[model samples]
Each structure stands twice: as C-alpha cells, then as structure tokens.
Target: MKKHQPAYLKSHSDGTLAKKLAAANARLQHCDLCPRRCLVNRQAGEKGFCGAGADLKISSYNAHFGEEPPISGTHGSGTIFFTGCNLRCVFCQNYPISQLGHGQPFTVRELADIMLELKKRKCHNLNLVTGAIYLPQILSALELAIKEGFDLPLVYNCSGYESLDALELLDGIVDIYLPDAKYNDPRMSKKYSQSADYPEINKLALKEMYRQVGDLILDEEGLAVRGLIIRHLVLPENIAGSEQVLEFIAKEISAQTFLSLMAQYHPAHLASNFPELSRRLTKPEYERVVDKLHELELDNGWCQEL
Candidate 1:
C-alpha cells in the first residue's frame, strides 16, 4: 500500500502555504481570527479576549496518548498545547494554561523546531491544541518545518467557535480537524462558556470542517490521516445539550461523521460557582446522551463509560 502524504505537503509544494501564511499574518494587525472578533492589534503587543500577543505562547508539547485511538495510535499524537483561549469556559480543565496563560513564548523558528522534533519522535500526527489565536504563527512555523522535511498529518484540535476566514486559510493545510461541539443551547453556552453565540458559530464551523475533510479516513493501521472529528463532552445536568448536538450532527452533518462522546466532565476552575455545573456527570445523564446517539444511528465513533 502507498504511504499517506499529508495535504500540507502539497500545499507547501504548490506555494499556497506561503500565500496562506501571508494572509494569516495580515490578520494579526486587526485580529479577527476567532468569533470574538476582538480587533486588538496583536502585532503591537495588544492583548485581546484570548490574551495572546504577537509571540506564540505554548504551555507544553509532547506525545499525548489520551486522545481518540486513531489520533493517538500506538505512537501517540504530538500535541502542542497553546496558551490562552477565545472562549472563557467556566469549567475549563486547563484554566491555568488557557485563562491564566502559564507558558513560555517562542518565535516562529523555535516553533518550527518543535514541530520537527515531534516528527523525529515518531509521533502519529502534529496535534495543535487550542491554537486558533496563533494561526499566523502556526502557518509560519509550518512553512519552516516543511522546508526541513516535516510531513506529519496536521491535527487542528480546537473549540468549535471558529471563523470562516481563519479556517479558509487552513483549507489545504490542516489534514485533520478535531473540534468540539460544546453546546447546542445559546443560554447554556452563554452561562457556561461566556459565549452566547457558541451554538450558532459551532454549527457553522462544523459544517465548514465537514466540507473540508468530508469524513474520517484511516489507514491500514487504523490511524486517521485526513478527517473531521467532533467531540461533544456531556456536561452535568444536560448543560452541554448533548441530544441536540447529536441531532445536528446526524441531520445536518453526515450521520457517518466520527464523534468522540466524552463523559469526563468533572467540575474544575470556576465550575464551583455554578450550581448546575458543580458536579461530575452522573451515569444516567451520560446514558441518556448515549441513547440519543444510538437512536440517531451515529455509530461511527467512541463513547466513554461514566
């Protein structure tokens, strides 16, 4: 069987990657990278809602084995956890990294070196976690990494609140999109994540991701190469609106779409402040969402046991 060549290699070869880098870099001056549309000029050291500046800030980078099977595989996914986030999720597990920004800054060249190092470590894919704010920097680093013969499949792991413009720049570059369909109810989204438009934006982002990658395609080794994987974490007391999220995926996106129905919703960060979100997901709550998944015939995914 022929080896799977990543989409970015072709994009790099055709010079489109350079164009994308240029386009993405231009947005840093008036930053509209995510749905927040915080027009702060990151180039001038202005911080926006995400709290990211000009430099690329990363909390850590390592071969992570905790992702979905295809993503982690036997070798593990090379995960780069970027600092800061557009959405301020009250129950964020990594609030110290995302909200408080506990990370070191790196230039584009250094970031490129990290990507090469991950490739050298024999990672299955380069998993970029919550890097929507650093789109330009990522593109710049990817361009450099490609020059150094880095060719691992790029996994864009992100919250589903994305901008079409930013996603368009990554059209032929990102091989796999791992985005979360966090909430289906605007009120729930607003109260929990501080993003009232999360549901509307998340739906559009999922459609765009599906349009780009179609469905998950695995190799002979059962490892994902190019695809869209939607993760829906079942929040306490149906706060995540899991049923409606499944319905949207089944009806709007293909029923064959790959999903990661997560059940590990433990209260963290500011979750204690909200009574509804102050506890771990009950088994009944999780099973109800699982029932909905089965009823919708969305069988091409993984479900966690509560």
Candidate 2:
C-alpha cells in the first residue's frame, strides 16, 4: 500500500509560501540552524564560519544514484548538493562543491523550479544533500514546489551535525529523515568535522528527527514515504565508530528503525591533508563494523558492503 503522504500545500494554504519566506528571513537574524551557531548577521552580509550568507548557492542538481536503495530507488534520487557545509571535514569528497562553493546563486523561484524539474523525472523525493547552511532557502523553495503540484516525499539527507532551532522550523515539513550518525567519539568529530560536541549535538538532532517521524515507513513500492533512516559510514582503522552510534540508535530511538550502514569512504579532496584519513577504508575495518552491527541486534534496514 502506498503510505499516507502529507499534502503540505493543502495543509497550509493560507500564506504558506510567504510564511516560509518570513521564517527563512527570521532564521538569518540569529543564525542557529547548524551546531556552529556563529551568530553572525547572515542577513546583513556577514559571512559565518560556514561561509554562507542569506544567498543560496547550489553545487549540483540532477538524478543521483549514490544514495541508498530506498532513496535512490529505481528512478534515482533528485539530489540538490548545496554549497558550503557546516562541517569542513578535511577529507571531504566533494570539496570543490561544498568548500569551493561551485554552482549558481538561485532565488526561491529558481530553487522551486529545480524541485519541480526533479519531480518531472519521477524522482522519489527531493534529496537535499549537505544543506545545513541553506535550510531556510530550501524550505522556501519547497513551499513553492508544493504550491506548483510537486508532491513527492521530501528527503532530508544530512550529516548528523545540525541545530535544534533550525530543525524546529521543519516541524510539519520534511517527510524522510536520512541523517548520518557520523562520529560517536568527540575527539574524532573534532579531528574530522571540527566539532567536538558532535556526539551530543547529533544525539539531540537524532531525537528531534525521531520525534518528527518515528520509525522508517516504506510504501507498498518499497520507497520510503516518511520517518527516519539513520545512516552510519564506517571509517578506516579501529575507528569503526559503530558501538556508540548503535547504542544510541537502539536505546534512544526504536531498535526497529531503519539504519543504512555505508562503506564508501575513499581518499577524496583534502583527505591527503589529514594523515589519519589519507587512504581508502580497508576491508578489515568494514568487516568489523558489520560484525558489531549483528551484535547490536538492531538489524532493521539496509547495510551495504564496501
């Protein structure tokens, strides 16, 4: 059976687009969407540590097969890779896009058009990747897309680094939450993503995501319709980082919730800059995380091999 998809446009007919714009405008004042919380005047053209102002910059947009099975499905996921991420991992794969900030500056209208174009290609949903700095813009575009008959599941494909204040704005918004449970250890997070508090913040953000959508709910066609799907990418070395992440998912969220374990870590962009992450993930490291997954007994979703 097809899962019940929320008609956000019909649900919020009264000034829906306008309200989203206003909210987007409001968020830039304090600017606490991601954990960085630079508190810079984003609206007044002050650049945050994330290197993003109110202007929305997109790196790439089109059908992408890099996502998990459910997200990419058969047709493929319509991914809009945003520019300038909150976390500047030294080993970032798409450093040119995320760090260099490639792509064009788009308004709400252009962003809405991209979403509509993706729906035209039979995309399962609009997968927003690395979009921490541009939540308000994405939401504003979503509002327009909804108004224009773009009715597909919205996928929040994010790194596990986000802010509660920003997430609170997406209360009735996003449908599928595909957040990565990246680093459980604070030292690893700081070394990699430059945030030592990643463990705590990611836990809190995961809780908020679970509260919005409980367990993963798939449609009759096996595509995700709503709910949360937490992803975990195993790194090389003993830094599999599975134990802490698994414990939190099983203990805090439902053990039955969907979990997608990733094994596609390679030396990309600035990986050479960081000695610890200067190479591809070894086979042994991947296998260890897999073994621990079974031990956790939270085998509820997809786990891909490297």
Candidate 3:
C-alpha cells in the first residue's frame, strides 16, 4: 500500500502554503474570516463578536480518543481546543472554553510546536476544534509546523457557519472537514444560535467542503485520510429538525456523505434559561432522527448509542 501523504505537505513543498498563509494573515487587518464578518481590525487588537484579538488563545491540546473511530484510530486524533467561538450556541457543552475564554495565549511558533508534538505522539490527525475564529494564526502555525516536518492530516472541526472566502484559503491546506449541521429551521437557529442564516450558510459551506474532499476515505487500518464528516446533534422537542437535515444531506449533498448523528444534548450554559432547551434529548426524539437516517438510506459514518 502507498503511504498516506497529507494534502498540505504537497501544498507546502510547492510553495502554495506560504501564499495561503500570507493571504489568510492579510484578512486579519479587516477580518471577515467567519460568517459574522465583524470587520474589526483584529491585527490591531480590536475585539469582534468572537472576542479574539491579535493573539491566539487555546484551552488545551492532546490526543483525544472520544472522536469517531476513523478520527481516533488506534492512538487518537490530536485535538486542539481553541478559545472563543463565532457561533453562540446556547447549549454549547464547552461553553467555558468557547464563551468564557478560559485559556492562555500562544505565539505562532509555539502553536507550531504543539502540532509537531502531536505528530511525535503518533496521532492520526490534527483536530482543530472551534478554530474558525483564528484561521490566520492557524495558517501561520501550520506553515511553521510544515517546516518542522509535522505532516499529519488536518481536521477542520467547526460549527457549520463558515465564510466561503476563508474556506477558499484552505482549499489545499485542510484534508478532513468535520462540521456540524445544528438546525434546519431558521427560527430554531435564531432562537438557539442567534443566527437565522445558519442553514443556508452551512449548506453552502458543506458543498464547498465536499468539493474539496469527496466522501470519507479510510486507509486499510480504517483511519480517515481525507473526507467530509457532518455531525447533527439531536435536540429536545425536535428543535433541530433532524429529518429535514437528513433530507437535505441525502438530496442536496450526496447520500453517501458521512454523518455522525449525535444523541448527547443536555441543558448547559444559557440553555437552562430556555424551557424547550432546558432538558436532555428524549429517547423518542433521538430515535426519530435515527429512523430518518435509515429512511434516507444514508449508510456512512457513526451514530451515538441512545
């Protein structure tokens, strides 16, 4: 079998990675990396809706085995949890890290070292969680890590809300896209995530991601090399509109698209304030989504045990 060479390695060797790094950094001057498009001068330490400034803030980094099988592999996916989030999901499990900014800052070179360290640990991939807020810095660190011979697959794990231009910058850089499809209804998205345009934005972003890397491809050892993995967390009272999301994925996107239908939803952060979201997902609600997945004949990826 041919050894799996990460996509970014070729981009780095051909000098496109440097060009991409420079372009990503340039956006910081008038940042519009995410869908928020705050246009704040992030390069000058001005804060936006995401609360990130010039420096990169990260909560933690380690090889995490809790991810899907392809990501975790025999060892684990190298997970870096970044601080602050562009999307303000009221029920976010990692609210402290994403909303409260519970982390220390790091220089670009230090961030590069973290990636190299994960590579040395024999991780399957570099899983960047909640990193849409710090794309420019990520590109810089990736450039540095490439120089240090860190050539693991890059996982662009994120909330579904993303800017097409920003994703274009990552065309040849990111190998795996692990994104969420939180809600199919605009009203539900507005109530939960404060973004009514989430469904449209998420669909476009997913299309772009699918274009970059097709369906999930696993190595002989069942590890993800390159692909699109969509996650849908079932919410209470069918607020997430799981059936519609599954319908869209089956029709609009490929029926062969890999999906991770999650059943872990509990009251956290501001979710307790909302009556509909103030409880865990019921068994019936979760099973309904599961039924839709089977009904749609979408037979790829994993599902959590209810």
Best by the TM-score measure: 1
TM of each candidate vs. truth: 0.99, 0.93, 0.98
Residue pairs in collision within model 3: none
The candidate that wins on lDDT is 1
lDDT for each candidate structure: 0.94, 0.81, 0.92
Candidate 3 residue-wise lDDT, 1-306, digit = tens: 987898998998999988988888888988898998899999899989888999899999999999999999989999999999988899998989988989999998999999999999999999999888898889889888888788899999999899899899889888999999999999999988989999999999999999999999999999999999999999999898989999999998899999999988889999989999999887888888898999999999889987
| Ranking according to TM-score, highest score first | 1, 3, 2
Could you report the Cα RMSD, in angstroms, for every candidate shown? 0.7, 2.0, 0.9
Worst 10 residues of 1 by lDDT: 276-285
Residue 235 lDDT, candidate 1, scale 0-100 = 93
Model 1 regions more than 4 Å off:
none
TM-score of model 3 vs. true structure: 0.98
Return the clash pairs for model 2, or none.
none
